[model samples]
Target: MWHMARPRKPLLSRARIVACALALVDDEGLQAVTTRRLAAELGVRGPSLYNHFRTKDDILDAVADAVCADVDLSMFEPYTEGAEAAEGAERAGSTDGPGAADWQDALARWARSYRAALAAHPHIVPYLARGPGRRPSQLRMADAVFGALTAAGWSRAQATHIGATMRYFVAGSALGSFARGFVDDAELYARDYPHLDEAHLLAEYQQRVDDGAFETGLRALLAGLAQPRDD
Candidate 1:
């Protein structure tokens, strides 16, 4: 007698599951994305998820990694190929001492890319404060920061400190943006306070704006980092 073949495993993999989890957080918020909930959505039992991921934290880490992957690392490079090639051409044509270069612009670009990505995945911003593993992607990001600082003539130690300070500020600001109500509940507050009503905190008609708070803090942090350390 021939036995019926078992159903092939679903095409779903761990990464897909993590992506689904990210969407759950993005749409319904993080509290809605428990392992049991995800398993049901995936058409698998709760324990089945453990076959792909050992624990809830493991799934969370994968989600953070997935979000961070959205940032473009090449743009964080100290000099893009085009910039480097142009510099080479400039050296060939002129006898100038050296072109004025500022690594702050590159670092600012890196911070902007980081803030934009993390703000989009606000739930995952916390994990970045804990730092990434010693993987190739993580190393590349670290290298990019270091490369930018070194190009501006900072020592290794100074560059490391500068990179850490920038990362912390970006992650912290993203968390703040996420806490601001998706639809600000100004109406509730306005009922009690006249000033709140006058300010129209819930005004959606205004053009969407970032308030530039993140960039402002970034500049402040850089100013501090550029100062001479007492120790």
Candidate 2:
């Protein structure tokens, strides 16, 4: 009797499992990611998932980490000096302390990249807002931000505030769209809402409008947090 050859690779895997779960969340919503639905999506029995993830939350945690892994932390790299930082260098008139403009440029780049990652998977934004929660990629991002800030002259507590403030702003921006909140009904807004005469056009201009808002906010935020401590 010939026995079935085990395929070169197992059909079920942690990566496959997480990918499928992420797809489920992306296609439907976070609530749609139950183990049964996930198993159905993966073409496996429900119990099969337990071999990799112990609970649904475990699967979600993995999904969250997977998203986190997409973020770019390279702007925080120390060797950035004399290259792009040099270009941004003259932009800073401050020789008062650590190069604040370099930090500002790094932050703007990081913010844009971070928002792009979260924007690609808007449905998962709620899960990500909960913070790092022991996720490796999330933890690494946090480390890079804090380390870079302190190295650039922020005290530990100030670095922590900057990190938290960035998270709040970025997460809130990614959570939903201001433009989409308005219905595209010109007639409806024309009468009662005087200022919203152009509001009806918002949804159609959603991406452009939202991108402008994020950029404006990011600029203001980086400026507000710009630091060259006196002490």
Candidate 3:
């Protein structure tokens, strides 16, 4: 008996293209993610990529959206619905009802999650600063943040400012590269720069330093935003 050939799998798709492109960027850098390279990675012709994405920027936008989709916005659910608020409160073991204070807590949790997402994909952090534009996932995150702030009784202007401030903080922290920037050799700092002598110690505790600084700044920002403002 003659056996028929197995059906050929689909060679290309938007999701496949995007996944390969993202992996290329993760392994190499954003600069290395050319259409030709991506096509090769997908085992297709360079022009085949155009079937899914119009240009390299389109692919990058998808990658950025993928990163944004990884962020945990569950904390903001309580702000939008009463049932979620009750559920979240019960899960957190909080006897006090969800209120403005809960909004602050949710925002803090959201901020941390957002930071972690960016930290995991440091190569994409630069592209993120360009704003959400037409990216659906990024837009959703912005909506959740703004909705939570407004629902918590903050004025539209205040909420907008707070959102901008938080984005700046998260983006800045991801771009700083503190761990890789610190010098581990004490001898690198001469007497002329005595203030840099202890810098070597920072290399051993880079994570703690970076995390502590972020938390401190985030707390201060939240505290300030929580206060009454003339505006």
Per-residue lDDT of model 1, residues 1-231, tens digit only = 999887776666897799889998888776778998998888878888888988887887788777777777765443544346556777799533223445677677778887788888887666656778743455677777776665555667888888888888778877764324435666766677756564445345322434455656777876766533433
Candidate 3 all-Cα RMSD: 5.3
The reply for model 2, stretches above 4 Å from the true place, is 1-10, 79-101
Tell me the tens digit of each residue's lDDT in model 3 across 1-231.
Answer: 999787575669989988887787777879989999988877889998998899999999999999999999999887778545756888999764445448778888998999999988888888889999999999999999998877676778988998999999998997766755867787876554788888778878888989998999889988876553547
Least lDDT summed over 10 consecutive residues: which range in candidate 1? 202-211
Inter-residue clash pairs, candidate 2: none
User: Which runs of model 1 end up more than 4 angstroms from their true locations?
Assistant: 1-10, 78-101, 134-136, 178-209, 223-231
Which candidate comes out best when scored by lDDT?
Answer: 3
Give model 3's TM-score versus the native structure: 0.86
lDDT of 3: 0.84
Tell me which of candidates 1 and 2 scores higher on lDDT. 2
lDDT on C-alpha atoms for all candidate structures: 0.70, 0.83, 0.84
Q: Give the candidates in order of lDDT, highest first.
A: 3, 2, 1
TM-score of each: 0.69, 0.86, 0.86
Candidate 2 positional error at 93, Å: 27
